[model samples]
Target chain A: MKYVDEFRDPAKAKALVKEIAALREMITPHHQTPLQLMEFCGGHTHTIFRYGIEQLLPDWIELVHGPGCPVCVLPMGRVDDCVALAERPDVLFTTFGDAMRVPGSKKSLLQAKAEGADVRMVYSPLDALQLAKKHPDRQVIFFALGFETTMPSTALTVLQAEREGIENFSLFCNHITTVPTIKAILDSPDMRIDGFLAPGHVSMVVGEQPFRFVAEHYRRPIVITGFEPLDILQSIWMLLQQMADGRCEVENQYARVVPSRGNSPGLDAIAQVFELREFFEWRGLGSIDHSGVRMRPAYAPFDAEKKFAVPKLRITDPKSCQCGEVLKGSIRPWQCKVFGNACTPESAMGALMVSSEGACAAYYNFGDLQELLQRREKEAIPA
Target chain B: MCLGIPGQVVELIDSEQMMAQVDVAGVKRPVNIACIVDEHHPPEACIGDWVLVHVGFAMSRIDAGEAARTLAILAELGDLQEEQAAMHEGAR
Candidate 1:
């Protein structure tokens, strides 16, 4: 806990809170609307709730959770395609632990596994390749899904498979990019994001150069943030300082993990294996152009999309679900009608409720402290 | 699922394959070091060096000095009167 424990120090957190307050005051009079800052990463969202960071902030500064949770944004149609591949008797489907619970149009991958499909959970793509080596007769399919953070490993695993001549292993590539998604969010009609707490992991892979447009085009300040408590608090403080200084730029608070220029070998592997798709569908957000990546033609032998006859169906978000609004920062997660009552984590009716990193799930799990604080505020008001 | 914890390299299980064992918060596990060992940047990963481990792969090598600097900034900024005031309110 050398790197972690120091980031969660209460004394440091207290100081950051004090600094954030003084900075928030500088921007308070400039705008009629609240100073809404969006943390554009689910990891940041998780840390904020886990450490009760929101409670330390003043009411004038509102933290809006963005659509950073990749699992939560995975369309039901894609899940259904995964189910289709898993149900094949000759195929052995593998995915991460959290992806098992994500519901398809009909059922989740867990449900498919329970019903006797060869759906397996793997810690990495190499493990899936190992499974393919073990079962030479069966087709091994890795349900690859994530941002630039996880892309390199999958690309390298595919490269390894090709080198070893592992004929039966392939990838169900749902790999997406972060820059286009951020652009999509910024282009949305109701976007009120004053600044951003950029995703550290993705930035570590793609670097801060990809996020220059957020500052250059949109004129919003973004601080690439770490996933620890003090990291979140310090990042929030950094964003506030930028607003106070009347400057819009991309800054790195998690400079320890993120370099100005990112991992080269990882980016090289990604360039070798994947190409941007024309448009890809997100669960809550609609089709974003050049947002998703597909396996290149050279690696077509390892592309699962061509190998299996998937039901390429487009499914809309549920009628009652306000995940789009929540993702867009137009509304808070709790304001959704189905939030706690109809769409708890146990029985997720929307995409946000499916993943722990999702805004709705984070709210359901750790947002009670803020809720209680709000309740006490309402009670204190003269009636 | 983008949880990359900083773990120290404990052992090299398969150096040719760039696979090594890293200890993350005391739990040791085998991880691929290929991504971090960029051709442009010489592979300096050795036993005892800290790397950011994400999904059984070493994403990047973490600089200890940079990590210390970040921690120092947080500590220095945390010294505030408002924070002291908030703590005093809690004491009451």
Candidate 2:
């Protein structure tokens, strides 16, 4: 709690807020365009919205969420695949807490569980292995979902499972690439971003190098920031300063962990175990070319897709769900139609509301997010 | 996708698979390295030595130059307050 609690100190957070407020005050009120800084991480999005970081900001500054939430942007078909796995007899689906409620082809893991499937939510991939050990007769498939931050844990789980000869366990890999997804956003004509609040965790693994491609090509300065309130506020200030000065380069404000080269061992482990597919389908993002990793041939025995077959599913996002637009940063959460009415934390219409880290869900449960969503119901044009 | 952090290897727990604790400003989390490629924490890795951890594996040992540079930057940020306070006093 030492490092964690100190950063959460309200006094320290307020001081940072004061600093950010001062930074905004210096800029003249009359401006051509409001500076829109794209936060390319879900953590930053949740932190900013949850803590009302915007409340502390000057009106000209705006924060746009990016494709950082692994759950929010996961295409419906993958969730449908997970639901199919959960529905199979003798198959135990192990996943993080957030994926349980994510809607998949008219059903979710939670719904599958209700219809008599063994769905267990775990905090780590190690937990899935433990579940497999406890239930030897059942096939335990860990819903391996995350960015580079979580891939090593998933990779290690397989290695350990293979080493121990655990035959009943496998993994459904949904780990994604932060840089390429960010590239997809930058490449989109809709990107009016002046700067970016880059992901803090991803930077630690791939290091500060991958982001250079983004900075160089997009010509948008990115400040890689941490998960806490102060980390986000500081990043916003740094981003604003960069935009004000017209600088486009990557800076590590979260240098306590991330570096230029990153952890080569982690990279090597993933390389040993997994390979990138030429293209994979993300529900909202469609088929992003080579955006995901799959198990290598060496680890085929442990690959969930190879080991087990879930019924091919025809899935669709709810007609009312505006998750696609929200993820694209075309519209904020409040701009979505089914935000609070059709999509509560308990009954989410899309992956955004179902994921614990998803901007909308993070707002709903942790940050009084439902109120804003409800407000949107009245504001949205009647369809 | 890199979300690796540097942690100090406390011990070679679990036989050939070393188990170590990673600290970031006194934040410590236990990580497994069976998946990472360090039969022995490279020559640079040792007890009380900082190694970069990703997904539960100690991937590589932290470089001294970069470590020093990070510490120096934090130090400079820490020094900013006193420097600014002194400047204000001189103005008064």
Candidate 3:
């Protein structure tokens, strides 16, 4: 906890909060609207809500939770495809624990397992590979999902499978890129984000270079942020300081873990195994070009998409779900029609309600539900 | 999951596979150190290095100097805030 406990020091957080409030005063007069800073990673959102960071901040500073949770953004069609693959008689489906509860069009992977599918929760891709090794007669498919932070691990696992001549193991690759999604968010006409807190772990693999475009092209001050409460507060302080100085630049608040140049071996493995798809569909954000990756031709033997026959269907989100608006920061989670009433974590109506890192789920689990609902009700009534 | 925890490299499990046993708090797990190891700093040199482990892989080596530097800056900021508060008291 050496790295963690130091970053969570309440005394330091209080000092940082005081500085942020002063910075807010300097920043507010320049713009008529409140300073909308989006923390583009779900991990940051989790930390923010869990620590009640939003309550501590001045009202003039609004923290818009962006769509950085990979699990939360996973399209329902993909979940259906996962179910189709899992329900297959010969396939032994393995996925991360969080992915199990994500609701598909018909049923989630958990439901599929309940109805009798060989679905297993794995800690790592290597564990899936071990399943392949153990069950020679069965096909082991690892549900590969996440952004660049997890891409290298799956890529390396594929390589390991090849090296060991394990022909039965494959990856259902759903790895996404961070930069394209950020670009999509900036390109939106309604996006009023003054700055950003970029995902830290993604930057650790991809480095600080990929985020330079946000500063140069979009003219937004983005600080690559850590997940701890202090890291987030310090990063916000850095962004506000930039605004106070009338500057737009990509800064690093999590420099201890993130290098300027990313992990070479990880990048090499990723380059060797995966190629960018033309476009990938997100649950709430729709399709963004070159946002997702698939296994290269050389790794087709280890590609589950290539090896297995999936439904490959396009399933739309429910009509009442305002996950799109919530994801875009156009509305708060509580403002969604089905938020706490119909989309509790126990029975999630949208992908955001399924994952702990998700904005809706975080709000539900950590935020005072009664207070949020009452505030929403008050806003709804005419003055 | 995108969360990466900082753990210290305890022992080398497999040099060829660039594998090492990393201790996170009290739990021990085998993690691949392929990303952190290279020609100059080989697998053997990573025995006592702290790394950010993400999903069975050591993605990056956590720099102690950088960590100390970040903390130092935060400390300085705290001192500056205290100084400003004292100045405000004097003015009042």
Model 2 earns a TM-score of: 0.78
Best prediction by lDDT: 3
Every model's TM-score: 0.89, 0.78, 0.91
Docking class of 1: incorrect
What shift in Å separates residue A136 of candidate 2 from its native position after superposition? 4.5
Q: How well is candidate 3 docked (DockQ)?
A: 0.25
Per-residue lDDT, model 1, residue A143, is 90
What's the TM for model 3?
Answer: 0.91
1 or 3, greater by DockQ: 3
Residue pairs in candidate 3 whose N, alpha carbon or C atoms collide under 3 angstroms:
none
- For all candidates in order, the CA lDDT equals 0.82, 0.69, 0.84
lDDT of 3 by residue, A1-383 (tens): 02222445768888888899887568888854678999989878877876678877888888888889999999999999999999899999998877998989889999999999999887677778878999999999999999999999999989989999999999999999999999999998878888999999998888888999999988899999986678899999999999999899999998878787878889999999999999999988889999999999999999989998877889888889988788777888999988999989988888789888889988898788999999999999999
Error of 1 at A270 (Å): 0.5
Task: List candidate 1 segments past 4 Å from native.
Answer: A1-7, A369-383, B39-45, B63-92
Per residue, candidate 1 scores C-alpha lDDT tens digits across A119-159 of 98887788788889999999999999899999998998999
Error of model 1, residue A229, in angstroms: 1.1
Model 1 error, position A275 (Å): 0.4
- Looking at candidate 2 chain A, the ten consecutive residues that score lowest on lDDT are A1-10
- Of the two candidates 1 and 2, the one with more favorable TM-score, higher being better, is 1
- Model 1 lDDT vs. the true structure? 0.82
